[model samples]
Target chain A: MSMSPYSFRLAAQSLHREKWINLLSVLTIASGLLVISVALLVAYNVNAATGKLPEKFALTVYLNDNLGREKIDALIGALKKKQSVAQVRFIPKDEAMKELKTMLKNANYVFEGLDENPLPDSLEIRLKREAVSPEEVKKLTGDIGRMQGVAEIDYGEKFLAALHSVKSGVRTVGLSIITIIVAGIIFVCYSTVKILFYRRTEEIETFKLLGATRAFIRAPFIIEGGVIGMAGGLISLMSVYVLYYVVLTRMSSVVPLLSNILFPLDLFLLLPLSGLLLGVAGAVIAVGRLRY
Target chain B: MIQFSNVTKDYENQTALRDISFVIEKGEMAFITGPSGSGKTTLLKLIYSAEKPDRGNISVAGWDLDQLKASSIPYLRRNIGVVFQDFRLLGNRNVFDNVAMALRIRGMGEREIRTKVFETLKSVNLRHKSDSYPKGLSGGEQQRVVIARAMVADPTVLLADEPTGNLDPDTAESVMRTFKDINARGTTMLIATHNRELYRNTGRKVIRLEGGTLVGVGPG
Candidate 1:
């Protein structure tokens, strides 16, 4: 029924006529979207901050005391050839002892009575990014432990497990918060549009009398709901930008790690698109509930 | 054209129509007259598919109501026009928009809608009040706007339930004159009213119902 312009015009008029109700709906949608966006921001930063932990984990490969220089060179070459190894460095017994003395500081006196250096030569291995997960790290450590002239491989299982736990926890909490906020947004849009529908019952009755199809009767209300959602989404997105620039960036100065976090530009489109769909969904459901 | 075959309509409390059968040929005008609760309105509602008959068949403008799907009701309505007792004008809209509603529902273009609505308003002698809302118009003017809306789409059938019940004698006469002119243009018109003066000397067929049952039919 050439409903595009007519529906849009009607929706705009209705929105203006019922400014207070529409304003309340927009605010409700904005508040819900704001909470979701803030949670997204926090999740983004957490992912950025914790994203580096896996790369920092090193596998300390201790060599046998009787291993020869040639055998050690061959072992280092093999470790370097592996896809999971990012870098490797050999630590001779003397160099290891020196490092221990530096770490011990004045406690080096405890080693003074030893006839010779008891520390074994080791390879400080840094795994590639792909090996950051606990399972991958374990596999890499096990492979190295079976290598010739390697006495043991330690990749700090407890530390890797703790990192995995934290990442998953943040993700689970972020998803849960977003789910709740989305539900609330839909409910708000549904009830608001339903109330708006009731307010215009007379118009609807007249439309029916004029032989208007159901789609024709429904289009304007759906458009109104969508406008509400889009406005709310855009407003919330702007607020998020303001919070990031005014609050987050300033906080980053005090907390250096926050500097690396980014608000992906894609969300500007995504949030409004999501809002439009959610708004349309609520309107459809609400209109379908009407008897006529 | 309209036809009712053994039509029986029931409400929660009582029967609204009882085994009634009638037919009005195409391009004819008829009036339904009876007391307040005599099923005049219910008969009109049945013709428009606003309510389904409990045990009967109604066919209007060549579409059978007994087998009509709910989804097809709008299209069926598109072929007919209905005017309500209370004017049924949208208070929020101006007279021009009110008249244009039927054409708009048909998805007619704006330029054409504007032209047709203006032409119809002119026919109703309310062209000057195009921009005035229903609340600003007189009862007769509002009723004229409703008539304009009904006739704007040029439907073959028009049904009016007491189109002039709230109007003064002069205004009501004017409305009847408009209906006569419309009926002369080959559109079938069925009007339900209790105003004896309207049908007294009109020489139109009158169908009378008493307590949901047809009591008589003859020229008034």
Candidate 2:
């Protein structure tokens, strides 16, 4: 059905006539959207933080102090042959001791009185980015610890597991919240349009007698729902931006790390578009179910 | 043209119209006059497909009412106009928009709608009240606005139920003149009223019903 300008005019007139009711609907939808947006923001930041951790991830393989140079070289070769291994750097006992001494330069007297270097020779192993999951790291460490010259493997097992856990948890909870909020927004539009339809029962009956089609009678309501949804989306978007700005510019001084939160400005533009689609869907359902 | 062959309609506990038959030829203006509860309104509703007959067939403008699908009812209605006893004007809208509703339903543009609505209102002698709301209009003026709305789209047939029920003698005569003018323009008309004065000596066909049966058919 073609949308006539008269439908738009009727919708505008209805919106003006029921301004208070429309405002209430918009505010309810906006509050729901704002909650969902904030939940999404938290999920995004947590995912980003967890995603970057893998780039600097490393597995330190401590070696036996008496291992020969050839054995160390062989171990390095074996590790490099593994598909998961990206790089391997061998540090001899003397170099390790020298690094420790440099790290303790502020208290040089403590090391100057030591009789011998007790540091172990180790191989710093970096893995492919895709293989940096907690399970993969655990399996790789297990295999290395079983190798001939390997003494122990230090991959911070607890920390890596906690990071992955946090990421997954945020995603699951965020999705659930978003789903509930979206349903709420749709319900708001549906109820509002239904009330408006009932309020105009006389007009609808008059239109029917005037030879108006179902589409013609329903067009104004659909337009009203879409306008309400889009307006709600716009209001929520503005609220989110204001909150982001306040956190970044004002509250960051108290909690400095809040400044590092990344805002996906481009992606957030979908809020109003989503709201419009949902609003139209709600109106369609409300009108479709009613007896004319 | 409208034809009813052996038509019968029944409510839950009462028969409204039963085994009734009549025909109003194309471009003919006729009247159905009966007392209250004599099924005059039900007969007008049947022609417009608002109420279906329990038996027999009805043909209006060549459309078989018995076979008309629900989806096609609106298209059928688009070619017919009904003026109600209650006026049925939108209280919130002014006189112009109320008349413009019929044309707007057909997706006419504003420029054309404005011209047609003004002309129709002028025909009803209410063009001066175009900006007035229905609450501000007298019963006669409101009735004229309803007539303007029904005539705005230029349908093939017009039906009126108690068209001048609430008006005084002068207003009722003026409204009758308006219906005659519209009928003069070659639109078929069927008016249902209990008052015999409307069709007493108009020299038009009159179908009379009493107690759910066709008691008589003659000329006014």
Candidate 3:
């Protein structure tokens, strides 16, 4: 049977009558969805930022202090011949010192009394896309370490591996937690609808006697559950937007990196859609459990 | 039209109807008079498929309940009206909604449902009480509202169980008069009641039962 206007009216009446229960359900769903949204936002930004880092990955090849310019040219030529080696740039001793001072900034006073520029000339070897992964980078570094004029090789391998591990861990844990919260939202909707159904047993029985199909009796409860979920979804969207705004405005001032991350505008639609699905699923479960 | 061929029903600890056999012609009015636990309510329940028989078969308005599918039960029920002793009307809904429920479930147009519900309410003398809730109406008025709800869809058969069990003689008679008026319009009726005065001198077919067994069947 088709759903009538009375079905919506019935849902509205029930929602109004049980305001406290509906409110509690909405709050629970909203809080859960908020957590999900925040997690998704963080995960997406971290992945996006890290995904860009591999393209900038570089291997620093330090040359021997006493080596002649010709030896350095030979090493650069060797690096350029390697597979997946995109480009090589030479950083002279003075330029390295200049970059170091820039990195140290106010701490450059420690190097003021040094008799000479202790930094060695280095080759900055950039990798192609295929060599950007940890394994390929490690192999390249090992090959460069055995070369003649290369006194040392530093690719920040440990740091990149740690970042990769952290990203993987966050993705795995975040997905598990989001799944659990979605289930919780569904349970909240189910329990609320079940409670409402029991409270309206008399009305349900009357509907049956009046020749209402099983679908007719179930449609209103489902609609009511969906309404509750949508309310929760709406509240969650608002909470997340407000949270993002606060983070953007206040927190970014103290931690400038926070300014780089943003909540996707499409989440405004996706989060509510998720909540609606959860609510409908909960209603289906609650109504399916009835004897009718 | 209704038929029960050697139908028997049982609960967990006792039988509700035993080897009951009967047939009601189309447009006829009959009374099921019996003592408490004598299967009067159980028999009426069979007519509407509320309770199925453990043995034998039943047919109501040409739907063979013995082979009735669960999916088809609603359609079968749409053609058979039922009135409970407790006057099962939705307390949260106004009388108009309560009576219009039958049409609403079937997705009838609002305009048609409104006119039909109003007319049905008038027939039960509850037109003025259309906006009143069930709690605001008296016992008899609530029962009349239930009757209006049952009759609003113009069901082919009406089965009522102890419809006046909680009413005084005057109110009970008034409720019966509404049933009689609906029945006069060619709707078959089967009423279950304990009050012997209800069936006496009525010149209607009476099926008497004692201890879940049919004891007598004759004109009252």
The candidate maximizing DockQ is: 2
Clashes of each: 0, 0, 0
lDDT of 3 by residue, B1-220 (tens): 8998999999988998899998889999999988898988888777777788899899999999989987788899899988888777887789999888889988898999999999999888899999999999988889888889888999999988898887889989888998899899999999998888878999999999999999988899
lDDT of 1 at B56: 83
DockQ of all predictions against the true structure, Cα-based? 0.73, 0.80, 0.63
Better model by lDDT: candidate 2 vs candidate 3: 2
Model 2 per-residue lDDT tens digits across residues A86-138: 99999888898888888988988888667888789999999898998888988
Q: Stretches of candidate 2 above 4 Å error?
A: A64-78, A81-83, A106-118, A143-149
Q: Is the docking of candidate 2 incorrect, acceptable, medium or high quality?
A: medium
The per-prediction CA RMSD against the true structure, in angstroms, equals: 2.3, 2.2, 4.1
Query: Tens-digit lDDT track for model 1 on B77-176?
Result: 9988888887788888899988888888788889999999999899999999999999987788889998998999999999999998999999999999
lDDT, candidate 1, at A277: 80
Worst 10 residues of 1 chain A by lDDT: A1-10
Where is model 1 more than 4 Å wrong at Cα? A1-3, A73-83, A95-115, A248-261
Docking class of 1: medium
Candidate No. with top lDDT: 2
